[model samples]
Target: GESVGLHLPTLSVQEGDNSIINCAYSNSASDYFIWYKQESGKGPQFIIDIRSNMDKRQGQRVTVLLNKTVKHLSLQIAATQPGDSAVYFCAENIAGRGGADGLTFGKGTHLIIQP
Candidate 1:
């Protein structure tokens, strides 16, 4: 089984700082990945995504780096702020067309904002 739980329950950071969250997936065959941000009770919002072929992808204030060699993944947030405080999730999907429902998500890292 994969590590569904986050190692850190909460991370506190000052405004205008940068934050990094980590996650590990279980399936070796999973080729698709997505990162989502959930603010409290809201649903997860798509942040960015990368395929197995790619090692790195980026978006506004956010970046996702994948390491197929170790099955490890990380998310980097630049210029973290109070609005950026939210629970982040990493999800993996099996590479293929049949697996449309392919989404196994890790627990989540809660980003706390300190004013």
Candidate 2:
């Protein structure tokens, strides 16, 4: 089962810093993974994705590192900013006879920023 409960939902940060959000997953058979960022009352935006065959993947200012051995994934922000304050979620998509499908999202981590 996935973790879902009344957990703290805000993270405070300075204008320029690094932020790391964490999520715990339930299913292990899931292979495809994606990290998404969602602002206040907005839809989730795709940041990056990684497959089971890959260990690490990088984007413009973000990097996604996957640890298949422990079924854990992390997203690293180069320089955190005010706009970077948002909720991040790690989704797992299991590929099987059905082909590619929708993602099962883990509980998100809220990122807050301070001036």
Instruction: Estimate, for each residue in 16-93, the C-alpha lDDT of model 1 and write its tens digit.
Output: 888888887767888888888899789999888888999999999998999888788889999987888899988888
Query: lDDT score of model 1?
Result: 0.83
Model 1 misplacement above 4 A: 3-5, 97-100
By TM-score, who's the top model here?
Answer: 1
Q: How do all models score by TM-score? A: 0.90, 0.84
Q: In candidate 2, which residue ranges exceed 4 Å CA deviation?
A: 3-8, 96-100
